[model samples]
Target: MASNISYKCPTCGAEIFWSAEKGCFDCIYCGDTFTLEQMKEAGAVVDQPIDEQKVEHAEEIVDGEYTQTTDGTVSKDLVKYSCSHCGAEIITDRSTAATICVYCGNAVIMSEQIIADFAPDYVIPFKVQKNKVMEAFKEFSKKPLTPKDFDCDKVVDKMQGVYIPFWLYSGKCDGRIEGEGINKKTYRRGDYEITEKRIHDIMRDGTVNFEMVPVDGSAKTEDAAMDSIEPYDFKDLVKFTPAYLSGFLAERFDEDADKCFPRAQERIENTTRSELEDSAAYDELDIKSYQKKTTIEKTEYAMLPTWLLYTTYKEEKFFFAMNGQTGKFIGNLPISKVKLVLYSLLGGIGGTVVGALLGMILG
Candidate 1:
């Protein structure tokens, strides 16, 4: 049977969760904070490895039938674990690493999912607290053309801190670019115009070494949205510990490293080609041929922090995401047709009044 784990305050016996503001686990009831080393010393952080034989046996039994509850049949992909705090049954898909129990609102970490080969090598814990994220989101939704009926408070209430899984790739790229550089000159001599044109063959070649090129490991996350929140500062990364996942929701990698390598490769190749082209330094460069090769040196699995929310306006869903480390927010807001028309009418009226005043002055 899969087991659930929740960090508990040693003094108050209440559930403790990671606090972004405090940079440690905090007890809401006792107003106490505990660091990673303190928790480990208290015996609160213990590894619970799943037994492979039992897991294989359970898989065989639940193969086709899944597990039928008294109420109804559950999907084969979904697994159920009892929440340690509330004893309420928590059901989640294979990709879910941690979640909050709906009944009691206590954080629950599925121990078996994040142990052994599935564990992440590094984690960037949430640095921006929920209140900070809320403030930033309010500023983001302050566009004049936004729909008045859209409730920012409601979306803010639904915001969740998630540790998104990513694959970090490091490699070296070598490439060459061959192009034609053209120069043109024009002058007037003795009342006669003369034009000169020169073309020269240019070739540039170089190598670029890159580290920590990130590609998200969740299929549900949009590639474009993930790309927009680029350039996470990898210097802040800490060794992965379950203590860091105490409060926030986390997802295991559904798409493995092999599946995500192509994206990293594409990014590296494009960067290498651009570097070579820049080195050529021509007024006008037309590329005739480009060739490159990438060799991956290292690949690591990591969990990065993000604040995410979803809301629907006029039946169209909108997604908001923020970089938990840097607080960079990104999302699309709905435009109010009424406001648009009003602004257009006001502008037209003002323009006509200005034109009439100019005509009177000229007459």
Candidate 2:
């Protein structure tokens, strides 16, 4: 009941895949070269909703027209696909967009993965190469006080590139804030000091338009860790195409965009408050009443590139993540107890010598 969706070279039967090195789909067997556009022209790549009716087709059927037989060859909710190499069953959940076969280690691109509503609008591909992970890791571990026992070599070698799902949101904020402020001035008259204080009620109302505030849509990813690596360059964001996911792994968004709005609003308000205070010339401001009205303008589902490494030391698991495009790494390394003790001893000796010199001087 499964489908084999491996892309192969036209001339030779060997599997041709997207190569990050070549930046295109290339065949290793017969030395055939093809681009994603070329494959789309050759009917090798397809997008759901059948956008290209201009090219010409014999028949067109609505999405609901496709029926799944009892054999489970095709269905909307759950699907079973077979590996072309081993004929083993490859199961995929409804939201799982793409994955590789565990049995044969071959790529399995589900045919009906992206339907009308579940499709992504943009994709940020991996700009970081496989060989660059270690360089980034070593740079991250080069701190002066880093533990001597922490090993960077073993962890960096096994780094994995995963396309994390994120929901990009835009909103408009109309905020009205009212608060009491205090102004104080001090003056010296002769031998006495006189202070004058003025208490005033202040009110401000403004609108803050936020564009492309992101929240991680996958529950598997830590929200703080993702936020630590800030600002994915949207200039490089591309229209989503399954061809771009050829060599990488991606997962469909499990959490809806609407669910991410609360966090977005909180962040927007915090930023708006800072901006308002910076613009104001008040001596002291305390916001007692706040009214923030927000409307979500846009929501987009996309796959963003990330490199994650997991390590365990002393029976404790550690996590490290790097923004694949920018190669910005964030992680905490363990401290060495031996180094800590030695530093403490040296500090104690220095303190004792300084104390003895002070005693002799006082005597």
Candidate 3:
């Protein structure tokens, strides 16, 4: 049976809304404990959509990111609470009592520092189901030179569903690069070899636009793991809806807009450099030196979708992720030391025997 979940404290019949200030769900009534998902599933808290008439940019802004202080009870309202246990920003309803702290898992309540930012402009649904993620991991482990126990089903099953926040920027760059190239020619004159060097002025410039370049916001996730799940289908993004966040843990952006801006700039600059290099052609190029100037006219923060799995092996935690829309699988798998050594020894011995047998047969 499919039913809407509620966020209520399992121990107490109190509604627990999330509080960014406290970084946990807090109960105003009984001081109970529960996360936002727990309370939302319990029918204790209800989110009323914003009324279009009240706000000028109601539809333009992302949900949870904006709040018109005067809007009379919209479908969505800015919620704030504080965890009394720990001082952390929590963003949820007043009914929320307990939630895992982003900084630390210790229970927290709403705090005073919680503030609102525009909600994500877009979201990608969990297209890659959990079972498929496990299968992908299993297949990943089976590659040649991979550990024998790398494909362990238990490790695959440990994967979890977490929605990570990412920012995507699109823009065009007009770049100019100057560099030097050398050409060498060999000629034999009376048994003498001559080499000539030619220096040329190379000027390369072009306009290249990159759409939906992704920058991860969650500090818990590493750049390498996220990059592994490349090629998210940004074309399928839908307006951010809390409904889509169902059944998975959604993490708010830990890094502020300003903090994340550098990443966007870095991605654009890197892309622009690559475009310039690709557009230019040079032979025997030592690239004595090169200088590039790029201009980014426009940029926007887009919430690219991702699913994260945090698991532990031998007491060490590791994360795996899949692009929610494109189903790109990414994460590092542990190689069993014993299995790797055994496989290498066996492969080496087998290769030596095969080589000897071939040599003997030929002789």
Best by lDDT: 1
Candidate 1 global CA lDDT score: 0.76
Where is model 1 poorest over a 10-residue stretch in terms of lDDT? 53-62
Q: What are the RMSD figures for all models against the true structure?
A: 8.1, 10.7, 14.0
Stretches > 4 Å off in candidate 1? 46-77, 184-196, 348-363
Off by over 4 Å in 3: 1-118, 142-151, 184-195, 286-303, 348-363
Candidate with maximal TM-score: 1
For candidate 3, the per-residue lDDT at 208 reads 70
TM-score ranking of the models: 1, 2, 3
lDDT of 2 by residue, 1-363 (tens): 222346666557566666644556778878887776776677674333434332121122224333222111244454455565787755554445556666776665544444456577887767777678777777766644446777778767657666777888887888887887777899999998998878888887788898888787765567788887757988768887766665555556767787777777788888877666665566788879888787888888877887777666686666678787787767665545565467557774355644443232210
Q: Write the per-residue lDDT of candidate 1 for residues 232-331, one digit (tens) a residue.
A: 8998898887767877888878898999999999999999999988887667788999889999999998999988886778987777788888887677
How many residue pairs clash in each candidate at the backbone level? Answer: 0, 0, 57
What lDDT score goes with residue 137 in model 2?
72
Give the CA lDDT, 0 to 100, for residue 7 in model 1. 69
Q: What Cα-based lDDT does every candidate model obtain?
A: 0.76, 0.65, 0.51
TM-score of each: 0.84, 0.73, 0.59
- The best-first sequence of candidates by lDDT reads 1, 2, 3
